[model samples]
Structures are given as structure tokens and as C-alpha cells.
Target chain A: MFDSHGFHQTAMAELAVAAQVSVGQIYRLFKSKEDIIEALVHDDADQWCGEMAEIQMRMDAGELTIVETFEQLLLHTIDEKDEALSFDILAESFRNAAVADTIGTMCQRFRTYIRYFACAANDKLSGEALDAAEEMILACLFGLGHRSLSRPRLSASSAARLTAEMIVTALGGVR
Target chain B: MFDSHGFHQTAMAELAVAAQVSVGQIYRLFKSKEDIIEALVHDDADQWCGEMAEIQMRMDAGELTIVETFEQLLLHTIDEKDEALSFDILAESFRNAAVADTIGTMCQRFRTYIRYFACAANDKLSGEALDAAEEMILACLFGLGHRSLSRPRLSASSAARLTAEMIVTALGGVR
Candidate 1:
């Protein structure tokens, strides 16, 4: 319902109907729409962290290059439903303090993972340089996901590979 | 109105109240909310193109380097309200085809501007390599705008400078 109608546009009644549950039941489980969105963001973050952990393990085991890990983790294909939900929540975050808090917390977790990758790729990258690199890469990853919305025919593979290379280059030119 | 309440959630009455015009007047001007949003996007894109054109003129006059042009054009500060409206429309574009077309056309114009920057930065960047570079740079620019929502404390200047350098490097190591 949120994906199709947007977060604010999806009324409790519409959500209840879509979920095949009573509005009362939803109220019992989630205090408000924001609460429901927070839960979804938390759940999604957990899954993403798990994927990052798996990739980190591969890197630890010497099975994946930094570029390969980025490809699998950040530069991977985006699911349309997930992308819509993420943008929905992100857009909502601008107006809702609580939603912003949730997104901020989730981004902090993601930042740590990105920092780990940066450190692994180049130990010399620390302080402001490291910070800039991480933010640049994060922005690139977020931007890549958004590209599909405007340029659907543009292949993700070449973009992904180039982004991965860019990350490698940005992180002290190591691949 | 759209920035705070969202596109789908904002009704004609609320918009009328906000605009200090009658709902009937709004109806006379715009057939629906989508029409209003299309007008806004078109207006925003025109302003963006004007800025790009000015930057291009500066680059042509040798008053600004390619890096400087990108810093001024793509990596400049993002207005919070504009950012929110963009994300709002981008999210809506996922579900609304008409909105998607508006965004797509705007992006095409922006893409041409990016291509010009890329070509000027590196004549060697051609065909698929050029396409990849443009998309990568576009994603980075978009991502930088979004970073403010999640991580407000991070300074954009360093990121912007680094991103400008990264673009130069990615375009073929010419600044």
C-alpha cells in the first residue's frame, strides 16, 4: 500500500484492507503509520547488515576483492519494490523527525560498513579524506539506485563496474 | 504544500488554502495534482538548465575549469525544499507514469549537460566508457544531494571537492 499510494497517502483503512486485517489489529501491532515504517526500515537494515557481514566474511577469507565486494554489496541490482519503499521512507524523513531518526540510525550502521571497506582498501585513508571518500561512495551507491527511475534502459552492469572501479580509485587507487 | 504533506497526500483544498486561492481556481489552472507537479518539475528543470548554460558559458570563456564547473553545477549546495520536492516526485514517479515522463525528460536534458562536461573533461571518454562515466557521475551528484537527509553533520564542501576530483579522474585524469 505504501509502495503504490505513498506513506502519507496510504490511510489506515486502505492498509488494513490491503493487508487483510482490521484497522484495530494494525493499531494493536503498530501504534501509527510512522511506527510501521520504522519497523520496516529496521527490518530492512538488519537484512542489509547481514548481507554486508557476509561480504565482509568473504573479504576476510581472501575470497573477494574490494571491488568485487562493493559490486556484490553496494553496486548490486536494486529491487523495484524495495527501491520505492526506500524512497518513500527517505522522502518522508524530510518532513517527519521520527522517520529521519530511523533513517539516520540506519545510515550510521551502513556508514560503519562502508568505513570498514574503505579502511580495508586503504589504511592511509583516515580522517577527513576517509570521511569524504565514504560519503562520496555512499552518494554514488544511492544515486545508482535512483538511475533506474529515470534511465531504465541504461544497463546497470557497466555503471556498476565503473562505480566499483571508481570506489577502488577513490580509496587510494587500490583494487 | 507538496514538500510537507507529499504529492498524493495533498488535496486540492489543502493546496488551495496554502496557495491562498480557491480550489476552483486551482482546478481552472491545473486539471489535477499531477498537472501541478508536472508544472513544478518543468519549471525546476528550466532553472537548472539555465544554471548549466551559464556554467557552460564560463567554461567556454575559460573563466572556470571543468572541475570548477562541476563543483558549481553538480556539487553546489542543495536547497532543502527543492530536495524534498525532488524526492517526492521521484518516489511518485515509481508509481505514476506521467510523473515518470516529466522526470525522464528533465533527466535527458541534464544528461546532455553531463555529457558535455564529460566530453570536455576528457576527449578519450567515448562510447561505453563515456556512458559509464556520465552515469557514474550522475549517480554521485544525486547521491550527494540525498546525503544531507541521513547525515546532516557531514560537510558538503570536502565531499563536493573530492567528488569533483573523482569526476575528473573518472573522465580520464584531466582536470
Candidate 2:
């Protein structure tokens, strides 16, 4: 419902109908729409963190190369469902402080995962260089999410692979 | 109003009041809110293209290095007003085909500007490598817009410089 109608436009009644639950039931489960959004954000973060953990383990075990793992991370940001809703909430975050805090927390968690990947990709990367690499990669992933709204020539996987290779090269080249 | 209240939530009357015009006058000027949005997008694109043209001219004159020009372009995407409104319309674009087309045109123009920068940054980059460099940089710029919502440790200048350097390195390194 949030994906199609946006957070503000989506009503509790509409969400109830979509979820196959009564409005009262929704109130019982979640205090308000903001609460629901917070829960959803946390749920999404947990899922992404779990996937990152698995990929991190793979990296540790030498099951995936640094570029491959970076590509995998970039690929995770391409889901249509998550992409639209994220833009929706992101706009809402501008008006709502609580939503901003929730989004900040989620972003912080995602950054931690990206930082770990950056470390594994280039041990020579440290301090400001490390932060820059992580932040640039973060921007790429977030920017890729916006690409679905635009027409791009490359397939998502191809785009992800190219982006990963670029970032890894940058990391390797950085002083 | 679209930046604060969103496209759907902002009424025609409210928009008229905000512009200090009567609702009927607004109707005379724009057929619908979507028309206003399309106009706004085109106006914004024109301004950006004008800026890019100026930068391109400077590049041709050898007044600025490739990384400096790239950083200047990246810095253009960081205005808070434009960033918020962009996210708002971007979410609306998911629901409105007309708005989507407007966004697509704007994106195409922006991509052209970035492509020129990519070519200038590395003469060897061509075909898929050139496209990849431009798209990756596009992602970084868009992602940087989103970073204002999150807390980024690096200042916009620092981030832009770091991102530009990284992408230029990748462009040079690409086979």
C-alpha cells in the first residue's frame, strides 16, 4: 500500500483491506502509520544486515572475490518494492523527525556493512580514505535505486558488476 | 509546496495561494498540476544544462582539470531544495506516467552532460567502459543527494572530490 499510494496517501483502512485485517487490528498491532513505517524500516534493515552477514562470511572464507561481493551488495539495492517505498519514506523523512531518526539508524547500519566490505576489499584503505570509499559505494547503491525510475541501457546485474569493479579499482588505486 | 507536502497532497488552490495567484489564473497557465511539474522539471534541466555547458567550455579552454570539472558537476546536485523536491517527484513518477516521461527527459539530458565529462576525464574510456563510468558517477551524485537525509561524515566538497577522483581512476584503469 505504501509502495503504490505513498505513506501519507495510504490510509489505515486501505492498508487493513490490503493486509486482510481490520483497522482496529492494525491499531492494536501498530500505534500509528509512523510506527508501521518504523517497523517496516527495521524489518528491511534486518533482512539486509542478514544478507550482508552471509556475504561477509563468504568473503572471510574466500568464497567470493571483493568485486563479486561488492556487486552482490549493489545488486541488493535494485528491488522495485524496496526502491519505491524507500523514496516514499525518504520524502516523508523530510517532514517527520521520527522517520528521519529511523532512516538514520537504518542508513548507519547499512554503512557499517559497507565499511566492512571496504576493509576486506583493500587493507591499505584506512581513515578518511576508507570512509570515502564506503561513502562513494553507498552513493552508488542508493543512486542505483533511483535508476529504476529512469531508463538505463545496462541490465541491473551488468550495472552492478561494472559499478563494483569501478569502486574496487578506486579502492586499490587510492593512496 | 511539493517539496514539503508532496505532489498528491498539495492542492491546486494551495499552490495558487503559494504562488500569490488565483486558482483560475493557475488553470490558465497550467492545465494540471502535472503540467506545472513538467514545467518545473524542464526549467530545472535547462538550468543544469546551462551550468554544464559553462563547465564544458571551461574544460575546452583548459581552465580546469578533469577531476575539478567532475567535482564541480557533482557539487551541482547537492541543493537541499532541489534534492527534496526531486525525491518527492521521483516517488510521484512511479504513479504518474506523464511525470515519469518528464523525469526521463531530464535524466537523459543529465546523462549527456555526464557522458561528456566521462569522455573528457579519460580518453581511453569508450563503449561499455565509458557508459559505466558515466552511470557510476551519476549514481554517486544522486546518492549524494540522498545523503543530506542521512548523516555523512564527509562534507559535500570532500565527498564530491573523493568520488570524482575514484571514478577518474576507474575510468583510467578500465581496459
TM-scores, in order shown?
0.92, 0.96
What would the per-residue lDDT of candidate 1 be over residues A1-175, giving only the tens digit for each residue?
A: 7876678777888889989999999999999999999999999889888888889999989999888877776555343345667778887888889989988999899889888988987898877777877887787777777787667444677667666776676576422
Q: Give Cα distance to truth, residue A173, candidate 2, Å.
A: 0.9
lDDT of each: 0.77, 0.83
Which regions of candidate 2 deviate over 4 angstroms? none
DockQ scores of the candidates: 0.57, 0.71
lDDT of 2 by residue, B16-133 (tens): 9989999999999999988998898899879889999999999889998988887887788754465557777787788889989988988898889888888887778888777778
Alpha-carbon deviation at A112 in model 1, angstroms = 0.6
The numbered model that scores best in DockQ is: 2
- lDDT, residue A25, candidate 1: 98
